[model samples]
Target chain A: MKDYIQKMQTGGDIVSAITAFVEESKKINEDNHYFTVITEAQAIEQAKNIQKQALTKKFPLAGLPFTVKDGICVQGVETTASSAILKGYKPVFNATAVQRMIDAGAIFIGKTVQDEFGFGALGITQGKGFQAPKHPDDPELCCGGSSSGGGGFTKKIPGAHASLGESTGGSIEAPAAFCGVVGLCPTYSRVSRYGLLDYGTSLDKIGPLTKTLPEAATILQVIAGHDKKDETSSQEPVPDYAASLGNIKGLRIAKIKEAFAEGVDESIKNSVHEKLTELEKQGATVREVSLPSLKEGIATYFTIALSEASTNLAKYCGMRYGQSGSMNTSFDEYFTKIRTHHMGEEAKRRVLIGTFARMAGYRDAFYNKALKVRTKIIQEYKQAFKACDVLSSPTMPILPPKQTEAHNLTPLQHLMCDVLTVGPNLAGLPHVSVPAGKAGIMFIADHFKEEELFRTHAE
Target chain B: MITQDVLDKVAKNARLTLTKEEAAQFLPQLDEVLTHFSTLQDVDTEGVEPSFLPVKLSTEMREDLPEECLTQEEALKNAQSKNGYIKGPKSV
Candidate 1:
């Protein structure tokens, strides 16, 4: 991976690597690893552009070939969001993040697959149309979801260093954890959402999944910061994230008491505890922190997310930019027929729950109540952070389950899998899931304090 | 307590047509999950400001500027059907 980066940086023989990967990508299409590959001509032009930038001393990404989830728009390329409804859709403009990477001299390889509209926590929602590659160790196991192809693509291209993905719930982290890669879910609005398909607009965040923490940090540095196009984009200066890595000697780390309790996989729990002990030996302090409200995070997250999802998805009626010609007698019929025929079952489930929550008489009962509950949950996190510089937990309660079994989970059962992740997302805190022995260890910190979290991990 | 009817209703609101079997399967799970959430109601939050974000934040604004948007063709290219004005099913 380092050699690939260097080649891209130096502009030497990088085209071969890009070409070989594109060919291999075609053969490995079952993983839905790539929706489209840049033609050789396009790859050469991108390399030339990087070389020109390097000559001018503006090499941020140099020639690094990165892939983005299809949900994000790339000018002239299809942004289908892995749904058959928008199979041939192409964007006329690039998402802010995509444009930033391009200006930094990064080569766009292709768009990766994702759960339809990024609503599922498991890759199964990509539907039977796009096949995800099985786990490397266990063929029957899932590769993780929403960003399934984004994460799965990392394993396929030993030469392609990192990829960008979006997370609403556990998409990036879950897939990264299962695939043994690093995933960074930046603070909400740290990256732009403009030009990306929305699913739970308030909860969705764009992040990177990379082979190493350093690589992830590099990508984050490049793509982060304010965007005029996205109203929610933060205007804060993007921190020197890579510069913060080093001795974490005196940092304090807290492990949520509930996360390691009953129901967690024994092996994963042991691995996390062992990692904490190692950090302690390295001179860091570790303690147990109470975050009682965290137990309700998943429930609250679904209520809030699905509620927003219902509204965000309302634009996809057979009237605007998705599957059309499915029905036309009435607006409601058109919407029902198009959505029912095109959206995956998972998308439908969330939309229903969201709609019900916002229904006139029930809004105060469900949506307003969930918002109140969300506030309480956030307060719990703030208090917990005061006692510790960084909080640690297993990235997932269990490792990736079999795809068949995952598909069998009822919607509620599947939402339960997001238990460990929803807390950080609800709080809009910065978190990164790094390899912790055999399982994954997620380190979350106060918003805009990602540097501190990295320092704690390094120590 | 969540019932099959409630599950069905939620599904309908979500624009899903759940089979009777699916409603049966999901109802009990939703009940058990909500029972677990009931524990959170015990926490004392009186007089505490509900937290919306982990870190205190003020919305930051960017200078307003005119920008280009996706062309009608580019925007509608992915639609299954298009009439140049909107994307949807063919009109009878």
Candidate 2:
């Protein structure tokens, strides 16, 4: 990350560099659907501002360009979260993360595409008028999502660039793993979600997807902190994350026993185990530990996430913001019309399931039961952390699959892709996914212990 | 398990109008999803208070201070609006 700022400081021609970057970005967006909107004009404008002020010496992220997940607001930029219902709705102000990154002098590149409302793992669930992004490596393979564009863009961007990725359940990690980049999700509330279109209020977190671990950390340092605009944002002291990359020696790595069983691909297992062995040889201790409640992770996470999401998405009725239909109808019919015509198939399905879980009679059975299970899941994580500083698992059970595979799965099966990533999410622990072998390996640290994740990942 | 009748009711409650094709495709899938998630009931969560957030939270209030804010024009920029208010569907 510092390399880009250094380059901008010494390389007298900033305008030419930015122009080439935009040209390359346009080509990549066309080839892979990596960006929903490439802010070429905005990027050039910001570049000119940097050149005029010579801000590289004053700002940490000066001259460093960053891409935002579509779910995040970027002032006048169209932030649709890849959903048709929100099409043409440009926020008047920046998301807190975007504002902070800009404050640190990161130039806005563009908004990246993802599953509508972050409801899918395969990147195939884009709303109407948006195409699911293809894997950067092989177009036939699916890009992991819902931060699919962030993952792909980070990998494709040559140097000193980062993408701000939001995760509710493994969105950042999945795409990063598939694209072979560093996807790090901070603890829930670690980064304010002020301008983000909500998915699940309790679970959503904004973090970074970068080509290198240190860049991820550097971006997090800029964005993670208290924001009064977001009530849930943490007040915990922000650490110097870029400077906190310490040796992993003596750190305990507790490998989850359940993550490697049954359905995981052998290639994925071999890669993570190889990393574990490498870490052990580098003086870190590794042990097999079981968090049995994790077996219920997918269930607990989806139930709570969807339940919260159902309510959060209720705000997108046609009149106040986003897509609108003719107003010659009753409120109910108008809402139904706008939603029916604009929302995507997967988005509608999620709302239905979420609404059902929180309805009367079923509320106690599904939503409430899931909430209790969430507590149990958190307890299990706490128990495991008692014996270990960091927990280890494969980021995903399967490698990035064929593009067609995303279409074949039932809704039940599709959500299973997030099984390994949800436990840490449910408990609000910090987790990072690093490129391992064919996929990426994930490590979870205790709440407020993002330093531990960076330290161990530095190895 | 979710039935068609339940789905229709839930969809309506959620302000969604599902087509016959959508309902047909999702009805069974939603049922199976709920059945799969029913496994969470097997765990003993008796007496466990639900954890809405993993971290402790307290209400954060800033001084009741006036600050420059979005203009009405800017606030209504994304919405269908006229005469300084967002236009909406007819309400009783």
Candidate 3:
């Protein structure tokens, strides 16, 4: 990683990185590791610029090589969101998170794959004209997504130290769990969302996926904090996250019983249980806690997610921007053709639910009620946190299903995989999903207390 | 109860075209989903304040100030089509 950084500092171009990445990616791609490898000369220019800043010690992320989910805007490069509608669309301004990383001296390695528009739990949801990519270790397995490419790149892209990905439900955690990496989903508004391509606005957050918790902490320190461009950004002072990594002795942790139930895969449950035992041995107090609200998390998550998604996606009419097609004489015809031609199955699915829930008669009955229920769910978590300083659970109920098996599962079944993740997202709490043994376990804390959570669980 | 027709309508409204076969497959699945959510109804939240953000926050109200924003040209560069105002597909 240091050599890669030095290479960039010494005027090494992105072409070299791209060449190395592509060669490495080809091997991984044969194992189904990635979807596409970005090869534009512009990446070289970006790397060189970042390198110059790094040499001056002006940037925290100087000389670091990173990948971003394809959904994020990187000026002059196609921000596909893994969708065909915006296949060649290139943004002129960077997403606030990407720009921040760039300003911190991080080199852009490439754009990684995602479920189209960061929509799905399983990584396979691609937009019109695209297909889901597979995993590096097993072609039949999934990489876990809407941040699949980012997760895949973290594992397979040679000399690539870390990557940025997004999460609505478990996009970051699921992939990290499957790929055996560290995924941090900061409290909502922890990172600015200025140029993020939306799927679910209220729940969406950009975060880092890295090999270790310390690296994640460092990356979060650099990319986090307020950006005026993003309405949802929090103005709170970004804490010294790296400085908080200390001894975990005497910390209180609660293991959610629902996350380790009979329905959970045996191997994953056992592995997580053993990790908790290790944490106990390390002087942390661990006890089982019941969170009945979590059982409803997936359903409530979808209600809120889809309702938000419906309105958020309305901006994609082909007449203004994005992919356009045959001219329609009527307004309805125009929308139908553009959306019909552009949106993938998953995007359409959520939009329909969202639109219906937000419709005139149904808004109060469905959308508002869902929000009320979401409030109640949040309350439950707040109450739970009173009993423990941090909450722990398996990131996913089971190991990632094979990509082929993923398509076979119903969408609701797929959503169930996020049962452990959605609660933290709904409550706007900070959480980190770290690799523990084979499966990943999530550690969640009250909002803005991510430092506390990370300090207690660093491995 | 989520029915096949409801599912189909939801799918269409969302702009997804699903075969009858797929609808049949998802109907029971969605029913199970809603059934699971029924668990939340048992929790009493009568007096609890709805938590919007986990952290207590007050929206920062700022005095109007000039700030750098992407030029209209730069913003429109990514737009599929543009006129004086950003153009989107006509909606009924």
> In candidate 3, which residue pairs get closer than 3 Å at backbone N, Cα or C atoms, i.e. clash?
A113-A149, A319-B88, A319-B89, A320-B87, A320-B88, A321-B80, A352-B14
- Rank ordering of all candidates by TM-score, starting from the highest: 2, 3, 1
What is the Cα-based lDDT of residue A427 in candidate 3? Answer: 78
On TM-score, the stronger of 2 and 3 is: 2
TM-score for each candidate, following the candidate numbering: 0.89, 0.98, 0.91
lDDT of 2 by residue, A47-159 (tens): 88877766435777777878999999999999899999998988999999999998877789899999999988988899999998888888988789999988988887776
In model 3, the runs with Cα more than 4 Å from the true position are: A1-37, A158-160, A457-459, B2-43, B47-55, B80-92
Candidate 2, chain A: TM-score against the reference: 0.98
lDDT tens readout by residue for model 1, A179-230 = 7888999988889888888887778889999888877878888889988777
Model 1 residue runs over 4 Å out of place are A1-3, A27-41, A51-53, A326-328, A457-459, B1-67, B70-84, B87-92
Evaluating just chain A, the predictions reach TM-scores of 0.94, 0.98, 0.93
Q: TM-score of predicted model 3?
A: 0.91
Give me the displacement of residue B73 in model 1, in angstroms.
4.8
| Candidate 2: regions farther than 4 A off | A10-12, A55-57
